[model samples]
Target: MSDLNTSRRTIVKGAAWAVPAISVAAAAPSLAASPEPTPDIDLSTSTPGAAGVVRQTDTQMNISATTFRNTGTVPAEGLVVTFAVDSGQTIEGIQVFGSDIKNVAQGATTSGYGTNTVTLTLAPGTGLGQVTIAPGSEYTSPVGQDILLGQAGAFNLTVTVQASNATANSVGYMPAPQAIPA
Candidate 1:
Protein backbone atom coordinates (compact mmCIF):
# COMPACT_ATOMS: atom_id res chain seq x y z
CA MET A 1 0.00 0.00 0.00
CA SER A 2 2.81 2.45 0.83
CA ASP A 3 4.53 1.94 -2.62
CA LEU A 4 1.21 2.41 -4.43
CA ASN A 5 0.50 5.76 -2.60
CA THR A 6 3.99 7.13 -3.57
CA SER A 7 3.45 6.29 -7.24
CA ARG A 8 0.10 8.08 -7.21
CA ARG A 9 1.65 11.25 -5.75
CA THR A 10 4.38 11.27 -8.42
CA ILE A 11 1.82 11.03 -11.21
CA VAL A 12 -0.24 13.93 -9.78
CA LYS A 13 2.84 16.20 -9.59
CA GLY A 14 3.88 15.44 -13.20
CA ALA A 15 0.38 16.08 -14.53
CA ALA A 16 0.11 19.46 -12.77
CA TRP A 17 3.21 20.78 -14.61
CA ALA A 18 2.16 19.31 -17.95
CA VAL A 19 -1.22 21.07 -17.94
CA PRO A 20 0.33 24.57 -17.74
CA ALA A 21 2.86 23.80 -20.49
CA ILE A 22 0.09 22.65 -22.82
CA SER A 23 -1.92 25.84 -22.22
CA VAL A 24 1.04 28.13 -22.97
CA ALA A 25 1.80 26.31 -26.20
CA ALA A 26 -1.77 26.79 -27.34
CA ALA A 27 -1.52 30.63 -26.86
CA ALA A 28 1.75 31.23 -28.70
CA PRO A 29 0.42 31.22 -32.26
CA SER A 30 -2.27 33.90 -31.82
CA LEU A 31 0.11 36.48 -30.34
CA ALA A 32 2.71 35.94 -33.05
CA ALA A 33 0.17 36.52 -35.86
CA SER A 34 -0.96 39.99 -34.82
CA PRO A 35 -0.18 42.78 -37.34
CA GLU A 36 0.98 46.38 -36.84
CA PRO A 37 -1.22 49.32 -37.81
CA THR A 38 -0.21 51.53 -40.73
CA PRO A 39 -0.43 55.32 -41.07
CA ASP A 40 0.05 57.01 -44.46
CA ILE A 41 1.49 60.55 -44.35
CA ASP A 42 1.61 63.24 -47.05
CA LEU A 43 3.33 66.67 -46.96
CA SER A 44 3.00 69.80 -49.11
CA THR A 45 3.77 73.53 -49.05
CA SER A 46 1.55 76.45 -50.07
CA THR A 47 1.93 77.75 -53.64
CA PRO A 48 2.73 81.43 -54.50
CA GLY A 49 3.05 82.18 -50.79
CA ALA A 50 5.11 79.28 -49.49
CA ALA A 51 7.56 81.25 -47.36
CA GLY A 52 8.40 84.83 -46.43
CA VAL A 53 12.03 85.93 -46.29
CA VAL A 54 13.64 88.86 -44.46
CA ARG A 55 17.28 89.57 -45.07
CA GLN A 56 18.91 90.50 -41.78
CA THR A 57 22.18 91.24 -43.55
CA ASP A 58 24.18 90.31 -46.61
CA THR A 59 24.92 86.90 -45.07
CA GLN A 60 22.00 86.38 -42.62
CA MET A 61 18.27 86.02 -43.21
CA ASN A 62 15.07 84.85 -41.56
CA ILE A 63 12.54 82.67 -43.36
CA SER A 64 9.08 82.53 -41.81
CA ALA A 65 5.45 81.38 -42.22
CA THR A 66 6.18 78.20 -44.17
CA THR A 67 2.96 76.21 -44.21
CA PHE A 68 2.58 72.41 -44.20
CA ARG A 69 -0.38 70.08 -44.50
CA ASN A 70 -1.07 66.49 -43.45
CA THR A 71 -3.55 64.34 -45.37
CA GLY A 72 -3.28 61.01 -43.58
CA THR A 73 -5.87 58.78 -41.95
CA VAL A 74 -4.30 58.95 -38.49
CA PRO A 75 -2.48 61.47 -36.42
CA ALA A 76 1.27 61.74 -37.00
CA GLU A 77 3.21 61.69 -33.74
CA GLY A 78 6.85 61.94 -32.72
CA LEU A 79 7.59 64.35 -35.57
CA VAL A 80 11.18 64.92 -36.64
CA VAL A 81 12.16 67.73 -39.01
CA THR A 82 15.38 67.73 -41.02
CA PHE A 83 16.76 70.76 -42.87
CA ALA A 84 19.34 70.41 -45.60
CA VAL A 85 21.23 73.43 -46.89
CA ASP A 86 23.96 74.10 -49.40
CA SER A 87 27.63 74.23 -48.44
CA GLY A 88 28.80 77.44 -46.68
CA GLN A 89 25.31 77.88 -45.22
CA THR A 90 24.16 77.02 -41.68
CA ILE A 91 20.79 76.91 -39.94
CA GLU A 92 20.91 79.15 -36.88
CA GLY A 93 17.45 78.82 -35.31
CA ILE A 94 14.13 77.09 -35.93
CA GLN A 95 10.60 77.48 -34.51
CA VAL A 96 7.65 75.20 -35.26
CA PHE A 97 4.00 76.00 -34.60
CA GLY A 98 0.92 73.80 -34.81
CA SER A 99 -2.35 73.15 -33.04
CA ASP A 100 -1.20 69.76 -31.74
CA ILE A 101 2.32 70.71 -30.77
CA LYS A 102 2.65 71.79 -27.15
CA ASN A 103 6.40 72.19 -27.22
CA VAL A 104 9.45 71.79 -29.40
CA ALA A 105 12.90 70.45 -28.55
CA GLN A 106 16.24 70.56 -30.26
CA GLY A 107 17.62 67.20 -31.24
CA ALA A 108 21.15 65.84 -30.94
CA THR A 109 23.45 67.83 -33.22
CA THR A 110 26.18 65.89 -34.94
CA SER A 111 28.10 69.03 -35.98
CA GLY A 112 26.19 71.91 -34.30
CA TYR A 113 25.86 74.98 -36.57
CA GLY A 114 28.77 74.07 -38.82
CA THR A 115 27.18 71.16 -40.64
CA ASN A 116 24.88 71.59 -43.62
CA THR A 117 22.17 69.45 -42.03
CA VAL A 118 20.12 70.31 -38.94
CA THR A 119 17.53 68.21 -37.17
CA LEU A 120 14.81 69.09 -34.67
CA THR A 121 12.07 67.09 -32.95
CA LEU A 122 8.94 67.46 -30.89
CA ALA A 123 9.75 67.76 -27.21
CA PRO A 124 9.01 64.70 -25.08
CA GLY A 125 8.34 64.87 -21.35
CA THR A 126 5.60 64.76 -18.74
CA GLY A 127 4.42 68.35 -19.36
CA LEU A 128 6.41 69.37 -22.43
CA GLY A 129 4.10 67.26 -24.65
CA GLN A 130 4.70 66.51 -28.36
CA VAL A 131 3.68 67.37 -31.89
CA THR A 132 0.80 65.34 -33.38
CA ILE A 133 -0.42 66.20 -36.88
CA ALA A 134 -4.05 65.21 -37.21
CA PRO A 135 -5.49 63.99 -40.52
CA GLY A 136 -6.73 66.76 -42.85
CA SER A 137 -5.01 69.36 -40.68
CA GLU A 138 -2.42 72.04 -41.33
CA TYR A 139 0.63 73.35 -39.42
CA THR A 140 3.13 76.11 -39.87
CA SER A 141 6.60 76.97 -38.69
CA PRO A 142 8.51 80.19 -38.68
CA VAL A 143 11.05 77.77 -40.04
CA GLY A 144 14.60 79.03 -39.63
CA GLN A 145 17.03 81.89 -39.57
CA ASP A 146 19.88 80.91 -41.85
CA ILE A 147 23.27 82.42 -42.57
CA LEU A 148 24.62 82.36 -46.12
CA LEU A 149 28.21 82.90 -45.20
CA GLY A 150 29.27 81.06 -48.35
CA GLN A 151 28.28 84.22 -50.28
CA ALA A 152 26.80 81.98 -52.94
CA GLY A 153 24.26 83.82 -55.17
CA ALA A 154 21.53 81.33 -54.36
CA PHE A 155 21.04 78.52 -51.85
CA ASN A 156 18.63 75.63 -52.05
CA LEU A 157 16.60 74.46 -49.05
CA THR A 158 14.91 71.11 -48.59
CA VAL A 159 12.75 70.05 -45.67
CA THR A 160 11.84 66.53 -44.64
CA VAL A 161 9.36 65.31 -42.02
CA GLN A 162 9.21 61.91 -40.31
CA ALA A 163 7.07 60.21 -37.70
CA SER A 164 7.09 57.07 -35.58
CA ASN A 165 4.60 55.01 -37.59
CA ALA A 166 4.43 56.87 -40.91
CA THR A 167 6.74 57.06 -43.91
CA ALA A 168 8.87 60.19 -44.37
CA ASN A 169 7.59 63.24 -46.38
CA SER A 170 9.75 65.86 -48.06
CA VAL A 171 9.46 69.19 -50.00
CA GLY A 172 11.91 71.58 -51.64
CA TYR A 173 11.89 75.40 -51.74
CA MET A 174 13.93 77.95 -53.66
CA PRO A 175 13.33 81.60 -52.87
CA ALA A 176 12.12 83.45 -55.98
CA PRO A 177 14.60 85.94 -57.40
CA GLN A 178 12.20 88.79 -56.63
CA ALA A 179 11.86 87.63 -52.99
CA ILE A 180 15.58 88.03 -52.23
CA PRO A 181 17.33 91.42 -52.18
CA ALA A 182 20.60 92.03 -54.03
Candidate 2:
Protein backbone atom coordinates (compact mmCIF):
# COMPACT_ATOMS: atom_id res chain seq x y z
CA MET A 1 0.00 0.00 0.00
CA SER A 2 2.79 2.47 0.86
CA ASP A 3 4.60 1.69 -2.37
CA LEU A 4 1.52 2.44 -4.47
CA ASN A 5 0.93 5.73 -2.62
CA THR A 6 4.54 6.79 -3.23
CA SER A 7 4.22 5.97 -6.95
CA ARG A 8 1.03 7.96 -7.27
CA ARG A 9 2.62 10.96 -5.56
CA THR A 10 5.62 10.79 -7.86
CA ILE A 11 3.41 10.79 -10.96
CA VAL A 12 1.36 13.75 -9.71
CA LYS A 13 4.47 15.80 -8.93
CA GLY A 14 6.00 15.03 -12.32
CA ALA A 15 2.82 16.08 -14.07
CA ALA A 16 2.68 19.38 -12.20
CA TRP A 17 6.08 20.35 -13.56
CA ALA A 18 5.50 18.91 -17.04
CA VAL A 19 2.10 20.48 -17.62
CA PRO A 20 3.25 24.11 -17.62
CA ALA A 21 6.30 23.39 -19.72
CA ILE A 22 4.21 21.50 -22.28
CA SER A 23 1.69 24.32 -22.41
CA VAL A 24 4.33 26.97 -23.08
CA ALA A 25 5.96 24.91 -25.80
CA ALA A 26 2.68 24.23 -27.50
CA ALA A 27 1.87 27.94 -27.49
CA ALA A 28 5.14 28.96 -29.14
CA PRO A 29 4.33 27.73 -32.63
CA SER A 30 0.94 29.38 -32.71
CA LEU A 31 2.56 32.69 -31.92
CA ALA A 32 4.66 32.35 -35.07
CA ALA A 33 1.72 31.98 -37.49
CA SER A 34 -0.38 34.96 -38.46
CA PRO A 35 -1.40 37.70 -40.94
CA GLU A 36 1.00 36.78 -43.66
CA PRO A 37 1.69 39.87 -45.68
CA THR A 38 0.34 39.53 -49.18
CA PRO A 39 -0.25 42.13 -51.78
CA ASP A 40 -3.58 43.89 -51.73
CA ILE A 41 -5.69 42.60 -54.57
CA ASP A 42 -8.52 45.05 -54.94
CA LEU A 43 -11.62 44.41 -57.00
CA SER A 44 -13.99 46.86 -58.62
CA THR A 45 -17.32 46.10 -60.24
CA SER A 46 -19.67 48.22 -62.33
CA THR A 47 -22.63 49.21 -60.28
CA PRO A 48 -24.84 52.17 -60.92
CA GLY A 49 -23.65 54.28 -58.01
CA ALA A 50 -25.69 57.13 -56.60
CA ALA A 51 -25.23 58.91 -59.93
CA GLY A 52 -28.13 57.07 -61.50
CA VAL A 53 -30.85 58.42 -63.69
CA VAL A 54 -33.48 56.91 -61.37
CA ARG A 55 -31.45 55.33 -58.56
CA GLN A 56 -31.52 51.94 -60.27
CA THR A 57 -32.25 49.54 -57.42
CA ASP A 58 -32.77 46.14 -58.98
CA THR A 59 -30.87 46.54 -62.18
CA GLN A 60 -28.42 44.05 -63.70
CA MET A 61 -24.73 44.91 -63.40
CA ASN A 62 -22.54 45.12 -66.48
CA ILE A 63 -19.29 43.42 -65.45
CA SER A 64 -16.75 44.21 -68.13
CA ALA A 65 -14.11 41.70 -67.16
CA THR A 66 -13.16 42.03 -63.52
CA THR A 67 -9.48 42.46 -62.76
CA PHE A 68 -7.12 40.83 -60.21
CA ARG A 69 -4.09 42.99 -59.66
CA ASN A 70 -0.96 42.31 -57.68
CA THR A 71 -0.39 45.45 -55.72
CA GLY A 72 1.61 43.42 -53.20
CA THR A 73 5.07 41.94 -53.38
CA VAL A 74 6.03 40.31 -56.63
CA PRO A 75 6.44 36.54 -56.63
CA ALA A 76 9.61 35.15 -58.18
CA GLU A 77 7.78 32.87 -60.61
CA GLY A 78 4.56 34.82 -60.51
CA LEU A 79 1.53 34.12 -58.36
CA VAL A 80 -0.87 31.37 -59.29
CA VAL A 81 -4.40 32.66 -58.77
CA THR A 82 -7.91 31.84 -59.87
CA PHE A 83 -10.82 34.15 -60.46
CA ALA A 84 -14.44 33.22 -60.05
CA VAL A 85 -17.84 34.85 -60.20
CA ASP A 86 -21.07 34.22 -58.36
CA SER A 87 -23.80 31.93 -59.70
CA GLY A 88 -25.92 34.81 -60.91
CA GLN A 89 -23.07 36.20 -62.95
CA THR A 90 -21.29 35.03 -66.08
CA ILE A 91 -17.65 35.43 -67.17
CA GLU A 92 -16.63 36.36 -70.67
CA GLY A 93 -13.67 37.81 -72.48
CA ILE A 94 -10.28 37.30 -70.82
CA GLN A 95 -7.45 39.77 -71.35
CA VAL A 96 -4.51 41.49 -69.70
CA PHE A 97 -5.02 44.32 -67.25
CA GLY A 98 -4.39 47.19 -69.62
CA SER A 99 -6.32 45.46 -72.37
CA ASP A 100 -10.06 45.21 -72.48
CA ILE A 101 -11.66 41.84 -71.81
CA LYS A 102 -13.25 40.38 -74.91
CA ASN A 103 -14.63 36.91 -75.39
CA VAL A 104 -14.26 37.27 -79.10
CA ALA A 105 -10.66 36.73 -80.13
CA GLN A 106 -9.09 39.25 -82.44
CA GLY A 107 -5.86 37.37 -83.11
CA ALA A 108 -4.62 34.34 -85.02
CA THR A 109 -4.68 30.72 -83.76
CA THR A 110 -1.76 28.72 -82.39
CA SER A 111 -2.21 26.00 -85.01
CA GLY A 112 -2.18 28.51 -87.85
CA TYR A 113 -5.95 28.04 -88.05
CA GLY A 114 -6.35 31.83 -87.67
CA THR A 115 -8.12 31.39 -84.28
CA ASN A 116 -7.42 31.29 -80.55
CA THR A 117 -7.90 28.30 -78.29
CA VAL A 118 -7.70 29.82 -74.82
CA THR A 119 -10.84 31.14 -73.15
CA LEU A 120 -12.03 32.57 -69.82
CA THR A 121 -15.04 31.33 -67.86
CA LEU A 122 -16.23 31.69 -64.25
CA ALA A 123 -19.60 30.63 -62.92
CA PRO A 124 -20.98 30.08 -59.45
CA GLY A 125 -19.76 26.48 -59.13
CA THR A 126 -16.89 26.66 -61.63
CA GLY A 127 -13.75 28.76 -61.48
CA LEU A 128 -11.51 29.97 -64.25
CA GLY A 129 -8.25 28.14 -64.69
CA GLN A 130 -5.32 29.37 -62.62
CA VAL A 131 -3.22 32.06 -64.27
CA THR A 132 0.19 33.39 -63.41
CA ILE A 133 0.55 37.03 -62.39
CA ALA A 134 3.86 38.70 -63.01
CA PRO A 135 5.07 41.10 -60.39
CA GLY A 136 3.25 44.44 -60.50
CA SER A 137 0.91 42.96 -63.05
CA GLU A 138 -2.80 42.53 -63.48
CA TYR A 139 -5.14 40.37 -65.60
CA THR A 140 -8.40 41.70 -66.89
CA SER A 141 -11.15 40.11 -68.85
CA PRO A 142 -12.85 41.55 -71.87
CA VAL A 143 -16.11 43.27 -71.15
CA GLY A 144 -18.35 40.48 -69.94
CA GLN A 145 -21.32 40.81 -72.20
CA ASP A 146 -23.81 38.83 -70.09
CA ILE A 147 -22.48 38.84 -66.50
CA LEU A 148 -25.28 40.22 -64.42
CA LEU A 149 -26.01 40.37 -60.67
CA GLY A 150 -28.86 41.40 -58.46
CA GLN A 151 -28.97 44.98 -57.19
CA ALA A 152 -27.79 44.02 -53.72
CA GLY A 153 -24.96 41.93 -55.06
CA ALA A 154 -23.60 45.00 -56.76
CA PHE A 155 -22.95 46.65 -53.39
CA ASN A 156 -20.51 43.98 -52.20
CA LEU A 157 -17.27 42.86 -53.76
CA THR A 158 -15.45 39.93 -52.15
CA VAL A 159 -12.01 38.69 -53.15
CA THR A 160 -10.74 35.35 -51.92
CA VAL A 161 -7.16 34.23 -52.48
CA GLN A 162 -5.54 30.87 -51.89
CA ALA A 163 -1.81 31.23 -51.55
CA SER A 164 0.61 29.12 -49.58
CA ASN A 165 2.35 32.28 -48.46
CA ALA A 166 -0.86 33.85 -47.26
CA THR A 167 -1.55 33.00 -43.62
CA ALA A 168 -4.66 33.69 -41.57
CA ASN A 169 -2.75 33.82 -38.29
CA SER A 170 -4.17 37.18 -37.38
CA VAL A 171 -6.42 38.42 -34.64
CA GLY A 172 -8.50 41.24 -35.98
CA TYR A 173 -6.53 43.21 -38.57
CA MET A 174 -3.32 43.18 -36.56
CA PRO A 175 -0.95 40.58 -35.18
CA ALA A 176 -1.22 39.71 -31.54
CA PRO A 177 1.79 40.53 -29.43
CA GLN A 178 3.94 37.55 -28.55
CA ALA A 179 4.57 38.62 -24.97
CA ILE A 180 1.78 39.48 -22.62
CA PRO A 181 1.99 42.91 -20.99
CA ALA A 182 3.84 42.76 -17.75
Candidate 3:
Protein backbone atom coordinates (compact mmCIF):
# COMPACT_ATOMS: atom_id res chain seq x y z
CA MET A 1 0.00 0.00 0.00
CA SER A 2 2.80 2.49 0.83
CA ASP A 3 4.58 1.68 -2.44
CA LEU A 4 1.45 2.39 -4.44
CA ASN A 5 0.95 5.69 -2.61
CA THR A 6 4.53 6.78 -3.33
CA SER A 7 4.14 5.85 -6.99
CA ARG A 8 0.92 7.86 -7.28
CA ARG A 9 2.54 10.90 -5.61
CA THR A 10 5.50 10.72 -8.02
CA ILE A 11 3.21 10.48 -11.02
CA VAL A 12 1.16 13.49 -9.85
CA LYS A 13 4.30 15.62 -9.38
CA GLY A 14 5.62 14.61 -12.84
CA ALA A 15 2.33 15.40 -14.46
CA ALA A 16 2.08 18.80 -12.75
CA TRP A 17 5.50 19.84 -14.14
CA ALA A 18 4.85 18.31 -17.59
CA VAL A 19 1.52 20.07 -17.96
CA PRO A 20 3.03 23.57 -17.58
CA ALA A 21 6.02 22.74 -19.84
CA ILE A 22 3.79 21.32 -22.57
CA SER A 23 1.49 24.34 -22.40
CA VAL A 24 4.45 26.78 -22.52
CA ALA A 25 5.95 25.05 -25.59
CA ALA A 26 2.66 24.91 -27.44
CA ALA A 27 1.86 28.60 -26.84
CA ALA A 28 5.46 29.85 -27.37
CA PRO A 29 5.52 29.00 -31.11
CA SER A 30 2.38 31.01 -31.92
CA LEU A 31 3.36 33.96 -29.70
CA ALA A 32 6.85 34.29 -31.24
CA ALA A 33 5.78 33.65 -34.86
CA SER A 34 2.96 36.19 -35.03
CA PRO A 35 3.85 39.76 -36.13
CA GLU A 36 2.02 42.98 -35.33
CA PRO A 37 -1.48 43.10 -36.87
CA THR A 38 -1.85 44.67 -40.31
CA PRO A 39 -3.63 48.00 -40.69
CA ASP A 40 -6.85 47.85 -42.79
CA ILE A 41 -6.81 49.43 -46.29
CA ASP A 42 -9.41 52.18 -46.92
CA LEU A 43 -11.42 51.73 -50.17
CA SER A 44 -13.61 54.80 -49.55
CA THR A 45 -13.55 57.68 -52.09
CA SER A 46 -11.93 55.41 -54.70
CA THR A 47 -13.49 57.82 -57.17
CA PRO A 48 -14.76 61.20 -56.02
CA GLY A 49 -18.02 62.20 -57.82
CA ALA A 50 -17.72 58.82 -59.53
CA ALA A 51 -21.52 58.81 -59.60
CA GLY A 52 -21.35 60.78 -62.89
CA VAL A 53 -22.54 57.81 -64.97
CA VAL A 54 -26.13 56.68 -65.43
CA ARG A 55 -27.17 53.71 -63.35
CA GLN A 56 -27.66 50.60 -65.46
CA THR A 57 -31.33 49.61 -65.01
CA ASP A 58 -31.91 47.13 -67.80
CA THR A 59 -29.88 45.00 -70.21
CA GLN A 60 -29.45 46.35 -73.77
CA MET A 61 -28.64 44.90 -77.17
CA ASN A 62 -26.05 46.65 -79.30
CA ILE A 63 -26.69 45.96 -83.00
CA SER A 64 -24.11 45.73 -85.78
CA ALA A 65 -24.23 44.54 -89.42
CA THR A 66 -21.72 42.52 -91.43
CA THR A 67 -21.58 41.16 -95.03
CA PHE A 68 -24.51 43.04 -96.60
CA ARG A 69 -25.76 42.43 -100.16
CA ASN A 70 -23.65 43.24 -103.22
CA THR A 71 -26.30 44.45 -105.68
CA GLY A 72 -25.62 45.80 -109.22
CA THR A 73 -25.15 49.13 -107.47
CA VAL A 74 -23.36 47.82 -104.42
CA PRO A 75 -26.00 48.59 -101.77
CA ALA A 76 -24.29 50.18 -98.82
CA GLU A 77 -23.85 48.19 -95.62
CA GLY A 78 -26.77 49.01 -93.35
CA LEU A 79 -26.11 50.61 -89.98
CA VAL A 80 -26.84 48.98 -86.59
CA VAL A 81 -27.46 51.05 -83.45
CA THR A 82 -28.05 50.48 -79.70
CA PHE A 83 -30.44 51.88 -77.08
CA ALA A 84 -31.26 51.20 -73.41
CA VAL A 85 -33.99 51.74 -70.80
CA ASP A 86 -35.14 50.82 -67.31
CA SER A 87 -37.01 47.58 -66.57
CA GLY A 88 -40.66 47.03 -67.63
CA GLN A 89 -40.69 49.82 -70.25
CA THR A 90 -42.54 48.92 -73.47
CA ILE A 91 -40.48 49.47 -76.63
CA GLU A 92 -42.93 50.77 -79.28
CA GLY A 93 -40.43 51.09 -82.17
CA ILE A 94 -36.88 52.02 -82.94
CA GLN A 95 -35.92 55.28 -84.62
CA VAL A 96 -32.97 55.83 -86.96
CA PHE A 97 -31.35 58.93 -85.54
CA GLY A 98 -28.54 58.67 -88.07
CA SER A 99 -27.65 56.58 -91.14
CA ASP A 100 -24.97 56.22 -93.83
CA ILE A 101 -26.14 54.25 -96.90
CA LYS A 102 -23.62 54.83 -99.71
CA ASN A 103 -22.31 51.89 -101.75
CA VAL A 104 -22.05 51.96 -105.54
CA ALA A 105 -21.46 48.97 -107.76
CA GLN A 106 -22.20 47.73 -111.30
CA GLY A 107 -22.81 44.01 -111.29
CA ALA A 108 -24.77 41.32 -113.19
CA THR A 109 -27.22 40.35 -110.42
CA THR A 110 -29.80 41.94 -107.98
CA SER A 111 -29.26 44.66 -105.32
CA GLY A 112 -30.23 42.88 -102.10
CA TYR A 113 -28.64 39.52 -102.90
CA GLY A 114 -26.42 37.09 -101.02
CA THR A 115 -26.62 36.30 -97.32
CA ASN A 116 -26.30 39.56 -95.30
CA THR A 117 -26.25 39.06 -91.58
CA VAL A 118 -26.83 41.44 -88.64
CA THR A 119 -25.51 40.68 -85.17
CA LEU A 120 -26.71 42.05 -81.84
CA THR A 121 -24.80 41.84 -78.55
CA LEU A 122 -26.23 42.34 -75.05
CA ALA A 123 -24.27 44.79 -72.96
CA PRO A 124 -24.22 44.37 -69.18
CA GLY A 125 -27.43 45.86 -67.58
CA THR A 126 -31.04 44.80 -66.59
CA GLY A 127 -34.23 44.57 -68.81
CA LEU A 128 -34.50 43.81 -72.56
CA GLY A 129 -36.91 43.98 -75.55
CA GLN A 130 -37.60 42.68 -79.07
CA VAL A 131 -35.56 43.81 -82.13
CA THR A 132 -36.72 43.85 -85.76
CA ILE A 133 -35.67 45.06 -89.18
CA ALA A 134 -38.45 47.25 -90.63
CA PRO A 135 -39.13 46.87 -94.35
CA GLY A 136 -38.67 49.56 -97.01
CA SER A 137 -40.07 49.81 -100.55
CA GLU A 138 -37.10 48.15 -102.25
CA TYR A 139 -36.01 46.22 -99.14
CA THR A 140 -36.76 42.67 -98.10
CA SER A 141 -39.85 41.88 -95.98
CA PRO A 142 -39.61 43.08 -92.39
CA VAL A 143 -38.12 40.60 -89.94
CA GLY A 144 -40.77 40.49 -87.16
CA GLN A 145 -40.18 41.80 -83.65
CA ASP A 146 -40.34 38.18 -82.40
CA ILE A 147 -36.69 38.44 -81.38
CA LEU A 148 -36.88 38.66 -77.56
CA LEU A 149 -33.34 39.85 -76.95
CA GLY A 150 -33.20 39.14 -73.24
CA GLN A 151 -29.93 38.16 -71.56
CA ALA A 152 -28.97 36.25 -74.71
CA GLY A 153 -25.33 37.36 -74.45
CA ALA A 154 -25.42 37.91 -78.23
CA PHE A 155 -27.63 37.06 -81.22
CA ASN A 156 -27.34 37.25 -85.01
CA LEU A 157 -29.94 38.18 -87.68
CA THR A 158 -29.33 36.60 -91.07
CA VAL A 159 -30.96 38.42 -94.01
CA THR A 160 -31.08 36.73 -97.44
CA VAL A 161 -30.82 39.57 -99.94
CA GLN A 162 -34.00 40.25 -101.96
CA ALA A 163 -34.49 38.43 -105.28
CA SER A 164 -35.10 41.83 -106.92
CA ASN A 165 -32.37 42.68 -109.44
CA ALA A 166 -33.24 46.36 -108.78
CA THR A 167 -31.43 48.50 -106.17
CA ALA A 168 -32.42 47.41 -102.66
CA ASN A 169 -31.16 47.53 -99.02
CA SER A 170 -32.12 46.45 -95.49
CA VAL A 171 -31.54 48.19 -92.14
CA GLY A 172 -32.59 47.10 -88.62
CA TYR A 173 -33.44 49.26 -85.59
CA MET A 174 -34.22 48.94 -81.85
CA PRO A 175 -36.87 51.09 -80.13
CA ALA A 176 -35.94 54.20 -78.23
CA PRO A 177 -36.08 54.13 -74.42
CA GLN A 178 -39.37 55.79 -73.54
CA ALA A 179 -39.75 58.03 -70.50
CA ILE A 180 -41.73 56.70 -67.55
CA PRO A 181 -44.71 59.01 -66.88
CA ALA A 182 -45.03 60.63 -63.47
Highest-lDDT candidate: 1
For model 1, residues 62-101, the per-residue Cα lDDT tens digits are 5565555666566655556566766456665443342212
Clashes of each: 0, 10, 7
Q: How many Å off is the CA of 30 in candidate 3?
A: 2.5
- Which residue runs does candidate 3 get wrong by more than 4 Å? 1-8, 31-45, 48-51, 54-182
Best by TM-score: 1
Better of 1 and 2 by lDDT: 1
Q: Against the true structure, what is each candidate's TM-score?
A: 0.49, 0.27, 0.19
* Reference-based lDDT, each prediction: 0.52, 0.34, 0.28
Higher-scoring candidate on TM-score, 2 or 3: 2
lDDT of 1: 0.52
Task: Summarize candidate 2's per-residue lDDT along 1-182 as a digit string, tens digits.
Answer: 66546687798999999999999999999889687565443222212223121212244334334355444454312122222333343333233332333323332111111111222223211124234444466555344323222223323222233322333431111111111111
Per-candidate RMSD, Å:
11.5, 14.6, 21.2
lDDT of 3: 0.28
Model 3 RMSD, rounded to 1 decimal: 21.2
Which TM-score value belongs to model 3?
A: 0.19
For candidate 2, what is the TM-score? 0.27
What C-alpha lDDT does candidate 2 achieve relative to the native structure? Answer: 0.34
